[model samples]
Target: MTGGLPLSGVRILDASHVLAGPFATYQLCLMGADAVRVERIGGDDFVRHHGGSAELRTQGMGGSFAAQNAGKACILLDLKAPGGRDVFLKLAAACDVVMENYRPGVMDRLGVGYADVKAMKPDIVYCSLTGYGPQGPFADAPAYDHIVQGVSGLMSMTGTKDSGPQRMGLPITDYIAGLTAALAVAGALHQKRATGEGQHLVVPMLASVLAFMGSYAIDAQTLGRERGLQGNAPFSGSPFAGRFDTVDGHLVVTANTAAQAVRMVRALGLADLEPLAAGTAPDALSEADRARVAEALDRTFRTRTALEWEEALGAAAVPAGKVRGLGEILAHPQTAAMGCLDDLPLPGLEDPVKLPGLGFTSDAWTRRPLSEPEAPGQSTRDVLAGLGLSRREIDDLARAGAVAGPGLPPRSA
Candidate 1:
């Protein structure tokens, strides 16, 4: 629905770092916004410790940061210094939106909170993303992705039934929070467009994560039923289910209705399951009968390799997919078919880096090519120049170690 690249002129100050904030800003960048990222001195983000590599240890550009920060310009600023705070407020007053992913009270302590910025620029959109919330009992609790997952009840639905309350393998809580923040900003911008008013947006990562868990929670709430992990299946208690092991890999065979189920059974070449389909209504089939049918479907699905099952499913118009790892998807033909893989140059690495493709398209072109993720604080001096800081003032900030961007690198020389 948002294919239009609607937010083209919008400029976003990506003060938020790590996954949640970066992911949201990335979305905005994809939608044709100028998203500038500001980082601390030395370019240190928490994910710098991802592996035991010398290059990564020094430069702090890990895969996690790269994934979130691609297609955005980056700068550096020392927010601790009084001069830094002054320059940051100046920049905040200049931008349409200011976004941050710090814990509650951090920005306020720095005197750059929404209230403080609102005084300087009345219509500025200020967004703060936190783990718990702006105000709550757990607001003071420090958190990471795993903690948010557990607190939001997402861990309850993550793994097998036996695994009880396990954290998700990926940083889903952080990611979803970013998406929520971006959505909130867009809504606020829309309102701003109409009223010429600015707003403060507080997005709690835990609450956003909880919204994801609510889909499962609603199903877990049937009169006396609590949803259990069937490993991987629909939360709707349907037999049109998931993750069947095949010869080469796994596949999820999901046919939510009897007709789709019939197609799925036929694709698996199970004539026996067809008769069971007749006894069960497409929508009204009891879970037990559906389970029995699903069991039969699983048996037949295993008869072929994942590739064969993919072909079989495609031929039958049934919803099916081979379970693929990240590498598998990148190398697979379907990823190219969907235009979700790209060959991009990365000078920092030995070879040109291959990465996931973009989401938006223009009037004629279906995809926009973007530069590789640069090191954090890469454009510290250049951005300040654009902010209209005089070369002399810029030189002073560089000397004071307060501001970064534009000709500052050469100051040490």
Candidate 2:
């Protein structure tokens, strides 16, 4: 590719955990950045658990963790302790970026805020992902993905008219904020290259979620029309395409262009479905006729299962699809054909770890995936050596309760 794993030499100190922050760092790792995830000294990142067996919990990982922390190194550090904070600062001096998802002032309270690190490394790019921006009345209010959806007006706009205030099933807000953070950090990196200075970024999940609802927000402002949910339908104020319940599961048929819509309606034996297509503009379809055509097509789609509709519509060159459950999609042959998942053997994670495999190469596609996530603090000794902490220094820190590594799971296969 033109960029050569563009961030090849970059170093990221990931103080963030959970979905958004860790996923962002995972993307960085794919781009060839050296991202070290710093965890609490008492244990590893708590993202590893959600009430599975104790052995699974002790392995300190789950499917969720696999998706987020796939390509980052885990280093145990107690930011609250004096020695731990010192070690973090030393690592900061060697890094290009620092990421955190703490409530607004938590890092400052720990004496490792942007100011502290900017002094040590002036060109550092520090990004903060939060539920709300810093310096607001709700700055300290705790937030998870679902809460952000409710608070950001996303829940109000989701689902059908009867099912009001439905939260998104996926973590949409978190992923959007992570993508925004990555974009901001990339921009800041470019500026730092020219100006020899760093920038502090504070992006909130609520704001990111709100941005995703731009069309609704715009309509409310300009048309004075309140947004309404229509369930699995686009808000383009047109029903050119809608979700249909097929023999098995569902399929969404979208023909955004009038020509495509014409092709679809003809293919479905509903040639007279819409009004005056030969006279109207290419992108414009009449409301009454469009509704009739959509209803006719909906009935036609129900004649077959989702997969059948998918293949038939694909042959007609129309955009149609069936949404697959995560597990089903993961196990499908296409997952391996596209090379999206790989089972990399790990030291302790019970099953061979499912490493995320995604990256684009101009030459072709990539088959060389990153190694799996290391066992917690697996490189503690080597990292301590790089930090110039002698074995005696490390022993002193260990004795002072400044460090620890992953304890093994009790039950073995």
Candidate 3:
């Protein structure tokens, strides 16, 4: 491990699951924070078998679980049980941060809510992430990424005008919530350092998604204009910006600037089809003119392969690249040069698994060597031992189903 990761020495007790909560803690874990994921005794994270192939579920290493949960330890404590709640309080008292992402009041009902944990550790940074917020009409509604996307107006603004509303291909809302929550946690930690006071942070998926749609929301309110999908068109409303088909495949090209637009038409040998704007002017072509230009460009782009167009457009300084799928992009030379994708081992897998890397770069943060993703509760005994629990006590708890790990009772069906 490289020295001086930003979150080094910080301890976080993460009692959350699914995507957003786990991902937020995962970020800290990657930065050398001691992120301990606490789950119910004899239970597994729903995501452990949520997606991916049947083989992954059998191996207890689902791709969805491994994708976001690297570099964290797992512990099992039945928080619903009195003994389990006691164990959790003990852990919270020793940790710097505690986080959970249940519906409003779920944690409080569990008796391990923010106030309860803060009582044990006055300066603990606590974050409660939820779908909406603690107090709102929709607060009690169950929400997932897609539901939030639709509610937040993201889906209404995506896709083509012809396709109607469409959900994004990925769980964008969950990730946005996770990233926002991580940022808030970091900021609260910083403030705590100066004031010697902990913070209670509320990270709402609806709020995060709205933040992502800030510009659109502002436009709707201020200009009385609601933006609609334009199907691969750039949000800037530039007619010169969209995906095009090459002789062999497709490519995405954006000539948003006037100069680039001129260069693009000229590059395609369509000098006669000069744009109405020039030299930093905004795209103002009428519908008919835009259609004519697009038709001509389409014919021209079809004259060359995607790679050829990519090179030619790149040489002319127009922003463009060949359209690529997930597999192709992951295996691309650029990804390899950045050291962003790695094949690491997963639990019950004989071979290394390929996964994406961190989003940001830091000279002081080197990813530690990869270890197989641990099964839920795999470290329960060791974690309890670190809390100074005697072997007899640990055994007693396990036998009573208050704590579970390798030798514990089978989960109720």
Looking at candidate 1, the ten consecutive residues that score lowest on lDDT are 357-366
Question: Candidate 1's C-alpha lDDT?
Answer: 0.74
Best by TM-score: 3
After aligning candidate 1 to the native by TM-score, how far in Å is the CA of 317 from where it should be? Answer: 2.1
Across residues 58-148, which tens digit of lDDT does each residue of candidate 1 receive? 6665666666577677877888854888878878887888899888999999888998888888999898988888787998888888888
Residue 164 lDDT in candidate 2: 80
| Candidate 2 vs. true structure, TM-score | 0.87
Any runs in candidate 2 off by more than 4 Å, and if so which?
1-4, 43-45, 51-56, 274-295, 331-359, 364-368, 406-413
Q: Write the per-residue lDDT of candidate 2 for residues 261-323, one digit (tens) a residue.
A: 666766676767645333223246567666665677777877888998788778888788887
Model 3 misses residue 119 by how many Å? Answer: 0.7
Q: What is the lDDT of every predicted structure here?
A: 0.74, 0.74, 0.82
lDDT of 2 at 383: 71
- Model 3 segments more than 4 A misplaced: 42-44, 275-283, 348-350, 409-413
For residues 188-281, what per-residue lDDT tens digits would candidate 3 score against the true structure? 9999899999989999999998887778888899978887775687765677778999888898988888888888877877787764535332
